[model samples]
Target: MRIFLIVALLLSVSFVAGCSRRADDRAPGGRVIVSYWEKWTGFELDAMQRVADDFNRSQDRIEVRILPVSQIDVKLMLATAGGNPPDLAGLWTFSVPDFAEKGALTPIDAALQRAGIGRERFIPVFWDLCSHRGFQWAIPVAPAALALHYNRALFREAGLDPDRPPRSLAELESMNEKLTLVELTRTGRVVRLPYAQLTPAEQRSHAFMIVRAGHLPQEPGWWLDLMGVWFGGSLFDGRRITADAPGNLAAFQWFRDITAKYGIENLRNYGATGGNFASPQNPFLSGRVAMELQGPWMHNFIGKYAPDLDWGVAPFPAADPAAGKDTTLVESDVLVIPRGARHPAEAFAFLAYLCQREPAEKLALGQRKFTALRETSPSFFAAHPNPHIREFVRLASSPNAHAAPRLCIWRECQEELRVAAGNALWGMATPEAALAQVQERVAWRWDRMQARWERVAEARRKEWLDRELP
Candidate 1:
C-alpha cells in the first residue's frame, strides 16, 4: 500500500510537470491547435505522429499536436477532474465505461455522425467497445485479436502433424500431453516440462475463447460474464447482482478442473524459469514452450528474433468440435474526446481524418497492429509484417468476436478475479469460495458506484434545470 501511494504520487507529480508546459491554444499560423494526449512512445509515438502529420497536411483549419505520456489513465483522470483535459486522448478500451460514467468523456455519437462515420465503418466488436451503457464514448484506433501460435518444429518432434492444429479441447489436451516432455533424473525428480504456460493476458484470451465456445456460462459480472453467456446466466438481471449464480459456480469448477490437470505448481515453476518474454530466449521462441495463445504482435518478435523458426497461427481451438470455429477475443486502443475540451469539433475532425482507410492502414502498418477499419486495401495485406495478418483480420471481422466486459468497475473486477483465480490455482481457496468472494466484493463496489452515479446525475439535472429556468 505504501508502494502504491508512492507510485501514485510520482505519477501525479509527473503529470503536473508535463502539463505545465502546455501547447499553444492556437498555432502561429492561426490554426486551431488540438492537443492530443496519447499513451504511446518510441515507435508507436512516431506512427501516431505520422497520422497526425497527414491530417495536418490534408487541412489548413486545424493543427493536431500529439503529446505522449506515461501512466496515461492516471494523468487523463487527473486532467479531466482538474477541468484541463486535452482535446483528444488515446485510451484503453476498458476505460470507456468508467470515463463515461464519471462524465469525463464527451459522447462521440453526435461527433461521429457529424463526421460522417458510422458503426459500419469499424470492426463490429471494436465499435461495440467504444460504447458504454447506451452512448458511444470512443473510436477504435488499433485493434488486436487473439489466436493460437504453435511451433511447427515442436509439433514434428512430438510426432504430431504440424499442419493439423488442434480443433477441439480434447485434441488440444492430447497435443499438450504429447508435446510436453517430462524429464526425470535417476533419483526420480522432474527435470524439465515443456508445454503451454499462459500469461495473465493469454489466460484471459483462453477464458474468453472457452466462453465463446459455449463450454462455460456467461454472467453480466465481468469476472464470470463469459461463463454466464455460455450457461444462459445473467450476473445482473438489470436490478441486482447474481454473482453466485449456479452457472457461475459450474464455470468456476471447470476452471478448477483445468488448472488441476495442467498442474498449477508445474505452471508456476515453468513461468519462474522461463526466459525474458521480450528476448530471443523467450520460451515460445526458444522451443521451451510448444504452443501459445497470442496476438499478431508476436509475429514481429518471431520475425526479428527467430527468423528460422517455423511456426503456424490458427484460431484458438474450441471446447467442443460442435462449437463455432472462428470465435476470438478482440481488444483495441481507442481515442476519446474528453469533456471540457477547448475544441471538440476540431479534435474530432482530426480523429475522423485518422479513421480514414488510408491513414488507419498506415497507422496500423507502422505499429504492426491490426487495422480497426472493417476493410483494407490488398496492398495492406501484401505488405503487412505479419504473414498471418489475414487470419487475424478475419477473426476481427467475425460475428463471433467479443470484447472485454464493459463495466465501470471492470479494472477492479478483473484484478479481483485474477487474485481469486490465482488462489484457486494454488489450492489456497476452493474455486467456489474464490468466486463467491469476488462476486460479493465486486457487487458491493458496483452498488456504491451506481449510487454515486445517481447522485451525480441528479446534481446535473438540477443544475441544468436552474440554468434553464434562470
Candidate 2:
C-alpha cells in the first residue's frame, strides 16, 4: 500500500525532486537494499559510507546504500507523509521530537529491547538525545559537546598565562577586554590602539572601530538561543515555557553588556571584517578573535585551515561556575527508520550493528568524533585525530550537560529566542522587554500545541510503545 502511494506520487515528486526513491526489496545480488538517506557530504558522508560498507560486509542479507541527500529533513518529512520514506535517515537529534510529533517515525522501543540495545549501552546524554516524550525514536551515531576553544598564542600575546583559561564568566569578560584591540582607521588607512587608550568621546565615535575582539557573543553563535543553558535556565521546564526565566534574562543581559562594552557600531564594523567560518580567514583562525565556544569538530577545520594555531580546549566559563560546573551543550547525529520504510527490520539490523562497540568506535574515529558509548577503548584515544577528544567526551558526561529540549515546537521556540537574542544583543530592546515579548508569544504557541497533543496523547502513547520492527 505504501509503495503504491509512492508510485502514485512519483511522477510529480520526480518531476520536482528528480524522483529520489527508496531502494527496492532486493539488490542485483539478491540482498535486501536498505536505502539510507543522509545529509552529510564531503568527508563526513564518507565516514558513514565506510561504516555502511563494514555492515554490508558483515552480512549477506542486507546491502545498506548510503545516499547523500540535500535538505534531508524537509525531503524526509515529505516522503514519509507521501508514504515513501527511505529505510533509514541521518538527522540531528533535535529533530526527533518534531518528526515523532508528525507521526513520521517508527518508535523502536520493542526492537531495542529485542536487540538488547538500552540506555546502558550508550552514554546517558546521547541516549536521551534520541528519545522524545516516552519513546526512543532513534539511535545516536556520533555525539558532540561545546567547550571554550581559545588561542593560547593570543593569551601569550596579551600577557596572560597560556596554560590558564578563564574560570568564570567574569574572568572571561576581563580577559576579553584585555585581549581586544581598537583601530582608528579613516579612508581605509590604518592605526591600531588598545581599547583602553581611546578617550571616552572616541569610544563612542564611529571613526574608532574594533580591529580585533577577544569574543563577540554572536560570532559563530550557533547556539545563541541555548545560551541560557550555560546561564542556568532552560527554554522549557517540561510543562511551561521558560523564556523569561531569570537565568535567561541574565543570559541576554550578558549579551547586551558585552555588546555595550564594545561599542555597537564598533562591533558592527568588526562584523563586517569577519571572514568565512570554514576558511583560514575565520576570525578565530586568523587570530583576530581570541576565544570561542566550539566543539571537537573544530579541530578538523583547524587542521585544514590553521595547522600552526596554538589552541586549548576547556569547559566554557559559566555565569556561576560553581553551580554550573561542567555545563555544556550536548548534541548528536542520529539514525532513524522513517515511517513506511520498505525494509524496517533489515535497516534496523544495520543500525543495531553500528551501535556495537567496534563499529561505533570505528564510525566515531573516522568522523574524528567520540562514540556515544560510555566506555571508549584505550586505542580510540591513542589513534584519535583530535588530541582533545577526551575533553569533549568528559563534557558530554557532565551532570549539567544538556541536549535541546524535546518539544515538538522547539524550532519555533528556538527562532523566537534567536530573535530575542538579536534584539537584546544589538541594543534594539532591553533584555527584559525582548524576552518578555518572546515569553508571551511562545507560551501561546506552546499551549495550543500542548492542547492538540493532549487530545491525541493517549493514542500516541499506545502506538509508540507497541510498535516493533515491522
Candidate 3:
C-alpha cells in the first residue's frame, strides 16, 4: 500500500508536469505513427518487428513504430499518468486486470465489434485472458502454455518407458521417486542410494545432498500458488480469495511433503551446484532435474545450451481425479491501446493485421510460441522451431487450461501466496497455517479493493461505457 501511494504521488506529479504526446507524432509523409512500446529484445523483438514491418508495407495510412522499453509496467504507468502513453503497449496477460481497473487502458470491445471480431476466432483460454470486468482489453499475439518437459534419457535410466508420460499425480510421484538420487559424501566415500531407503536420521543429516531431483517444485517455482487449479480450485473467484480452499490445502500439503522428504539443505546444495537458468548447467539441461513444468520457450534454451539432450513435452500431471486431465497454464504477450492514446484505430489496425492467420502463425513460428488463433496455416507446424509446438497448442485448448485471475489485486495475491507456499515448502509452517494467514490477509486486501471500487464505480463505469473507438 505504501509503495502504491508513492507511485500514485509520482503519477500526480508527472501529470502536473505534462509531457509531449509522442503517440500523436506523424511520419514525413503524414502517415499516422502508432507508437508501440514492447519489452522484447533479440529475436523475440525481431519476430514482432517483422510483423510490424509487414503491416507497414501492406498499408500506407499507418506505421507501427516498435520501441524497446525496459520495465514496461513502471514506464507505462508513468507515461499513462503523464497523458503521453504509447498508442499500443505489449504486455503480459497477467497485467490486464490492474491496468484496466486503473483506467490506464482502453477497452477494445468497441473496436472488436467494429471489426466483427469475436470469441470464435481464438482459443477460449487465450480469449478469456483478454477480457476483464465484462470488457475486452487486449488481443494476443504470441501465447505460451505450460507443460511437463522430461529428460528422455533419465526415464530410460530409471527403467521407465520413454514413450509414456505420467498422467496422474500419483504416477508422477512414483516416477519421481524412481528417478531421484542421493549421494553420501563422507571422507571421500561416495555412494548413491534410492531416497526411499534412507532412514529418518540419514534423511535429516547434512552429510547427504540430493544430486538428482526428478521434479523439485521449487526448481523454477513459477506456478506454486496456481497449483490449486489442478486440484480443483482457484486463488480468487471474482469476489473472494480462496487461498485456504480445500484444493489449495491439498496442493500445499503435497508441497510440504515433497519439501520435507527432499530436505532443504540437500536440495539447496544441489541447486547451488547448477548454473543459472539460461546457462548450459541449468539443472534441467544438465540432467540434474529430470522433469519440470515449463513453457515452449524452454525449447530455445535447450537448443542453445544442450542440443544433445533428449526431451519430450506432455501436459502436466494432475493432482486430482477430477478437473485434472490435460491441465496447463497459459500466458501470452498481448497488445493493447492505452487510455490516453491518440491513434486507437490505427494502432488496432496493425493489431488486426498481425492477428490474422498467416501473420499470426508467422510471428509465433518466429518467436517459437503458438498463436491464440483457432486455426493455423497448414505449414505452421512444419516450420515451427519447436517440434512439440503441437502439444502446447493442444494444451492451450484444454478445458482445464487457466491463466492469471482477472482481479486488480492479483499481483499482490500472487506475491502473498508465493510467500505462503514458501513458508510451507521451507518448513517454517504447515500448509494449513500458511494458507490460512494468506486467506485472512488477502480477504482484507480484497475488502479494501472493494471499498475503493465502490467509491470510483460510478465515474469509471461511465467513462468506459461512453468511450468511443473510431
lDDT of each: 0.73, 0.88, 0.87
Model 3 agreement with the true structure over 1-470: per-residue lDDT tens digits: 99999999999888865544332378989899999999899999999899889889997999999999999998999999988889999999999889999999988788888887888999988888988878889998899999999999999988899889888988888898888888885457888876655677876664677878889888788899788877887787767877888988988998899877777777767777978899998999999999999999999999999999999998888886466889888889999899989889898898788768988987898899999999988799998889999999999998888877888888888999999989988889999999999999989999999999989988988898877576
lDDT of 2 by residue, 181-233 (tens): 87786457787776656677766664677778887788788888999988999
lDDT of 2 at 127: 94
Best by lDDT: 2
Error of 1 at 308 (Å): 2.1
Candidate 1's residue-wise lDDT over 149-202, tens digit each? 888888887788999998865687668766765442324553443334334443
With candidate 3 superimposed using the best TM-score fit, by how many Å does residue 164's alpha carbon deviate from the native?
1.3
Q: Over 4 Å off in model 1, which ranges? A: 1-23, 186-255, 262-264, 458-470
Q: Which ten residues in a row have the lowest lDDT in candidate 1?
A: 211-220
The list of candidate 2 runs beyond 4 A from truth reads 1-23, 185-191, 196-207
Clashes of 3: 0
TM per candidate comes to 0.82, 0.93, 0.93
All candidates: CA RMSD in angstroms? 9.2, 4.6, 6.3
